[model samples]
Target: MRVSRLSVVVAAVVSAVVVVVGSEGAAVAGAGGAAAGGGGHEVDLAFHGDVTLRAGVVRVRFVPRNHGPSDLADATVRLRWSLPLVGVRRLPVGCLRSGGGGVLCRTGALEAGSLGEPVEIAARVAGRPAEVRVRIGTEWSGGAVDRNPRNNEQSVLALDTGDVYYF
Candidate 1:
């Protein structure tokens, strides 16, 4: 059979498109499967911390513990304050400033039955408030399924009286 140049070019283009689309679909499927913990990548992340507010300055110290059968490659812990933060002068190695009243910290590679590096953060609040409500939770669990999430989430109310409030 004789084939025209245009027909040959069209065939090549269709083959390239099919390859691209197929790879994209596979990537999506892989991500979804991992997120669903299809391969039994189950991990439990526990959040434990204390907060202190004194003279418009807030200080926090937290530790993320992993009790699991699978290791966690990476994870993100989120903290949201009731009052707006004016200045954040200090943060742990992997922590970063997030939204106005929020911060996100990375828990790097937590092994099973191990505790991640302890993190401490100090920031100034916008103004003097009677009390501040701090909420801490696991923002990302590195695609691992946590069966018991209760210990990984906490809400603490810290007053301006300069007392340490444990979550």
Candidate 2:
């Protein structure tokens, strides 16, 4: 009886160990299977810093990240500035390449003929739009100019043709 009980105890302990090990292996296998299946990749889009207007030129930067599974393509950025009576003008869209760090975009003069203070600025990825109010000014402090009076600076801006993003 004693020998039988000892054998039973040993068998029970071994069975428990085998079950635990088997379950852990199965869990790992399940995780691997899930990973093998198609999972959507996550991408992060960040603005490097605030938009700066100096000497009539507007400088903007964007940072895009491909978390993995896929790469971002055909990314386009549109800049719009609000004018008093003339309405909103769609500035040329610039194509940016992803460097080791991020994507960068710089805009030409706020105005073609002269530098006009911009009331608002926006960035769009693909066809989506994200806009922000921008403080436009020159290096020389003539005075604070309010370009957007009615606060209707929120405007839909478009990019010029032939401008697009490449992964």
Candidate 3:
């Protein structure tokens, strides 16, 4: 059977799409590459309940879960860990290096059932325990879609502070 020119072009197009779709993101963790399944799985990155509000900092455990069967190459949690205490002269809680919209934490290539890292947000407070709010979700710019949007963002109140934390 003779192949038509149209068939050749169609074949090329299909192959290109396959290659592009197949490599959504390569594992940055060279050692973690073995766990990647290349199935374009979605990740659920969020913070667990009950964060620690101590000192001049608020800390939370960022959990990036792979609800899909396929393993993900990477995951990130962008959050405004803590807002400045009410009436306090301070900006939002800064991550390790607080900047703007929110702080960012990353998990490089989660191996199916893997726990992510702990993200700390430093807040400026004074006197009695300050009341602040922390938010977690996509970064200021953008990020991948959460497998579950309902849990994409979480906010908690940090009240009743003593001399434990400072600016």
Of 1 and 2, the candidate ahead on TM-score is: 1
RMSD of each: 9.4, 20.3, 10.5
Evaluate model 2: give its TM-score.
0.24
Candidate 3 or 2, higher lDDT: 3
Q: All candidates' TM-scores?
A: 0.76, 0.24, 0.50
Model number with the top TM-score: 1
Q: Can you write out model 2's per-residue Cα lDDT over 24-121, one digit (the tens) per residue?
A: 97765555442544222222221222353332223343332222223323222333333211221243345333322123233222221222222223
Q: Indicate the worst ten consecutive residues by lDDT in candidate 2.
A: 135-144
Sort the candidates on lDDT, descending order. Answer: 1, 3, 2
Task: Assess the local accuracy of residue 66 in candidate 1 as a C-alpha lDDT between 0 and 100.
Answer: 91
Alpha-carbon lDDT, every model = 0.87, 0.32, 0.50
**What is candidate 1's lDDT per residue for 1-167, written digit by digit as tens?**
99999999999999999999999977755664546656447788998889999988888889999998778899999999988999998787888888899999999999999999988888888888878888899999866778799999999988999999987
lDDT per residue (tens digit) for residues 80-161 in model 3: 6344333223323333334543556655565555555544444444433455566766542123334466665677666545
Name the lDDT of candidate 1. Answer: 0.87
Ranking by TM-score: 1, 3, 2
RMSD of 1: 9.4
Q: Which regions of candidate 3 fall more than 4 Å away from where they truly are?
A: 1-40, 54-56, 81-101, 120-129, 140-145, 161-167
